[model samples]
Target: MSKRYTPREMLEKLISFNTVSDRSNLDLITFVETYLAEYGVTSIRVPDETGTKAALHAHIGPSEDGGVVLSAHTDVVPVKGQAWSQDPFASWVSNGKLYGRGSADMKGFAATVLAKVPDFIAADLQRPIHIALSYDEEVGCFGAPPLVRDMLAKGPRPSFAIVGEPTNMKVVTAHKGIAVYKTTITGHPAHSSQLHRGVSAISAAAKLISWLDAQTADNKAKADPDNAFEPPYTTLHSGVIKGGEAHNITAQHCEFITDFRLLPGDSKEAWLEAYRTFIDSQVLPDMQAISGDCGIEVEELAYVPGLSEEADGLAETEARGLTGDNARHVVVYATEGGIFQEHGVSTVVCGPGSIDQAHQADEFIELVELDRCAAFLDRLIGRLS
Candidate 1:
């Protein structure tokens, strides 16, 4: 088999696997594992509790301190209900663009690296190059932590990490952190005609959502004056809600899910605590007054940390040099850079394709963008060597 494949071919191999965030990524992992095995590259698997959805971590070159890592997620969002002229799982190229699920949001980055195996394996390098692929990144960013933790526990991790989520080949220094949660409100049920006899879970949820709305607006007002990002500060919004079985009968259950993207230096736990207190002091009391057993429960869906705001460091300098640009900016979308940074690894975000096309219908990555990504990896190999 040829060590070096083209970007289109590499992407086709990846797209064939239905590695949705909810499904196991073993097939994708197996393909990557087999490809790397041919080059004698060893890998470590970070398996989830169910023994599915493993994140593959591998390093090429010497396993010493101060190496660099190229990172991309393996999971793709569901294609259901999306309007796509072509099969979302089949790679299609038209007018110098490749279209498929995960084409731009990521898999493009993964494919570009895989396509350049010859360049990496053939290079006589002084420092190592690590490839870290994770799962479940599209669904609340619920992957990559265990792999990162496992790497740190062994010894010093890489010095720099490049989270390749689509930046059109530019260097992104900062992004907001995400804290997701689900709340279930429980209350007694009775006939709607006798409203005062039993508690209403729907009413409690309404009050809680109202408080969250006010808090979200306040956070928006107190946002930092950074024009680099779209929202410019921490933002909050609800994604899912369920309640009320019948109009005439009193509903006994209500569940809602919310997401808060925190700015740098903000505390996720503090925000959660305040929300719980608001429910306990304000909404819970009113409900419990009607029924002694009324209660509310909150569960953490996922927590992805915000990228560090500071960027005047080695990673930034090197990224600028490799990309042949001195201008750097911040993005509002989250990435795995923060997770890697927390483990004492200097991380940055740079990749091919524009983020505007990510997670959208009929997504694509331009041929020129894939070329640029391959060139970036090539330049990175030269720089490390």
Candidate 2:
């Protein structure tokens, strides 16, 4: 007979996949589908355009009425530069902590859900339970929209979705939206001595970056006093910039990637439009004056909208009842909770572990946190049954 595995054992198996955002999550998806199949639950796969990655959606119990969904992402961030004491893909336990890449951020939640599959199967539930697993979330939440769209199109749409995004079992009702963009500047190249003959792309990029800094500061100054988010304002910054080969030559091309986090009810389009206008009217015109071919291109890379507090209290109430927490938090990070909310699902974020441990070297989740999550799920199962 096959040995029955606990949540920790299942998490050990999940950690072995190495489902980094850049790599395909097909192997992990297959493992989950096969595991669910053994318990007589069939999952629906929504594949990305390339067919290399997919999101899995499955429902257990009566599907006639709207039910609750447990949401999680399958991908883990890369550990390329992070220093780890052991293999990041192979989990280990020491001093009451489970250490691995996705151990805390959050294969732990997925494992807890899977570990309770037997209980879910045996329970006589009046309402269904949903399991939503997606790919490539660490990159930019790229995998959630398609999966959510598929869920909406199909019948028995979930009324509430609980995104397990490692809130240390606290219920989080709101989080900031994220918008990412890449801006490229092209210019005429000329030798350093003939600087006037060339439009320096790097110089133009520098000015734009400086302008972004000023704009960010202005944003900080204009924060709404009533906003609940930290700093009570939308924030922006550029993370990557690239240009130029040597000091002797003017760079012909320069590029930088920037992103902003928006408070709920803030207008993302308004901010993006203002930046685009500045690029077109100020940056491009100056470049064009030096060289007609010189130009600037701004492209939107990814967007994940914020989860608003406007959601009806159904999910929040359920989560609070399960965890016995009366307070709700507004987080600084983004999650699939936003996407679910935007698509008309009342969503709340609650899970084990801490965001502080996420994407860090030697990332680990406390065994106590896992136990808490298991108990929370047990309460959820009891309520559903």
Candidate 3:
């Protein structure tokens, strides 16, 4: 007989694995596979190109169309540089809160879903329930597309997908999208005295960064006050910059990372095109005039599409019905719900814990949150049955 674990025990087991975004989550994946197999639930593993990481999906109940998908990510941000009260990978309960690296940022929801697997199996479900756990959601939503693709191809189509992101168990209908870019500027080097002869890549980079800041400021200024998002506008930011070697010498190369968090209905392509046009028409010409070899390159590092509120979305309706939450909610952070929604699965973000506690030292989830989530799952099971 398979060992049964309560939600807390399962959370402890999951948190014990150091499945940081940079590290392999295969161990966790293997454990999940084994646990599910013990209960006769077969799972599919969609491995990354390196096979060092993977995404897992499984279906329970009758294999039929219009099932519901419980989506969660297995990876957590690194614990380095943060002063934690205890081991981040070791689960602990104190003051009625569960403390761990991924307790709130997600693994909480995954654990809850896993703990209820037997209940789902035991229930005579009229519609199936699909479990999807993805990797590399922190760095970017890198692991979800293939997982979604494989799950759809192998199993019956799901009518709705609930991405268990930390939302305090509230039904979130929309979220911002994100696109990361790396811009490299090459310029002719010269002595500081001959300013005209050598184009300063650092100078060009500053101008470009300034342009991004100006655009962000403009967006903020024109933003609607009544918009649900906190900022209520698209945001562009450059967090990392590296270039200058010496104070006197004109920097030959400068590189920076620019990321855009765009509200729903905004076009990433349009923004990218406009940025490129500015660089090619204005920035590059000045540098190339100084030296023919001077150049600029912009590469897209990652992209996660934004989730838009769907018209009468089944996921939202079902989640609202289960939780009895009627308030409108939209988040600024990007989640894999966008990916699912893109694939025609009506998706909503609803799960245990608060996003406020996610990715911080002493990250934790209130015990009552887990209880509420369990109750929500029970309702879902009842509805499906």
Candidate 4:
């Protein structure tokens, strides 16, 4: 007989594995594959080029089109700098909450889905239920596109996809898109006293960062008050920066990472073009004038399209039906739903826990949240049946 685990038990098992974005999630993937195999379900692995990471997908029920997909990422952010009350990889229940690194950010949703696999299998589903687990969602939604591509090619075409991101189980019809970029500034080195002889990469980077800040402020000022997003506008943020050899010398090299979270209807290309124009026409020319070798390079690290609200979308309709949540909701965070939506699948973001609890020290999800999620899945099973 196949062993069955409760949602809590499965959550404990999942939390035991450290699937931090920097580490390989193969152990967790293998465990999921093995567990599904126990129930006679076969899943496909979509491995990255390095084979150190993979995305997994499985289909249950009749092999046919117009199915539903349950999507969630398997990776969690690093807990290195966090001060946790207990081991981040070890699951513990206290005060009606389950605590762990990925509990809220989203292993909670995955655990609930896995625990109910047996139920899904036995539900005599008329339409298939696809399970999609991807990697590296924390760094950026990098792993989802390939995973979605493989799923579309290999399995029954899914009509709807529900991304299990932490949204307090609210049905989210739209979300902001994310574009990550790294800018490297190259300049000539010279003594600080000889400012005119050398281009200071650090100073150039500061100016660029200031430009991004100005854009952010401009967007905020013109934001729509009626928009559902938290800030109701696109946002620009520079997260990491490094460079400079010494205070006495002009820096030869400097680099910084920045990201833009654009509203659903905004054009990422337009923003990129404007930014590049500023660098090429203004910043780069000034640097090169002082030192011929000085230059600026901008590289796109990742890009995730935003989820746009669809007219009577099947995923949103179904999710709203299951949760009885008719309230309009939109998220500022990016999720795999955008990737799925871009591929022509109607997608929505709905899952347990609050985003506030995610990626925090002693991260936890309310036990009641998991219960609510399980109930939602049960309703979903019934709908498919």
Evaluate all candidate structures by whole-model CA lDDT and list the values in order.
0.85, 0.89, 0.94, 0.93
**What digit string (tens of lDDT, one per residue) describes model 2 on residues 195-216?**
9988889999988888888887
Candidate 2 collision pairs: none
lDDT per residue as tens, model 1, 9-88:
89878988888788899989988988888877778888888888798888878778677888999999888898999898
- Model 4: CA > 4 A from native: none
TM-scores for all candidates: the values are 0.96, 0.96, 0.99, 0.97
> Candidates ranked by TM-score, best first?
3, 4, 2, 1
Span of 10 residues, lowest total lDDT, candidate 4: 1-10
Q: List model 4 lDDT by residue over 339-372, tens digit each.
A: 9999999999999999999889999999999899
Report the C-alpha lDDT of model 3 over 1-385, residue by residue, as the tens digit: 4789888888889999999999999999999999999999999999999999999999998889977999999999999999999999998999999999999989999999999999999999999999999999999899999999998888788999999998999999999999999999998899899988988999999989998999999999999999999889999999999997788889999999999999998988999998999899989998898899899899999999999999988999999999999999999999999999999999999999999999999999998998889999999999999
> What's the ranking of the predictions by lDDT, best on top?
3, 4, 2, 1
- Candidate 4 overall Cα lDDT vs. reference? 0.93
TM-score of 2: 0.96
Q: Which structure among the candidates has the greatest lDDT?
A: 3
Candidate 1: TM-score? 0.96
Candidate that would win on TM-score: 3
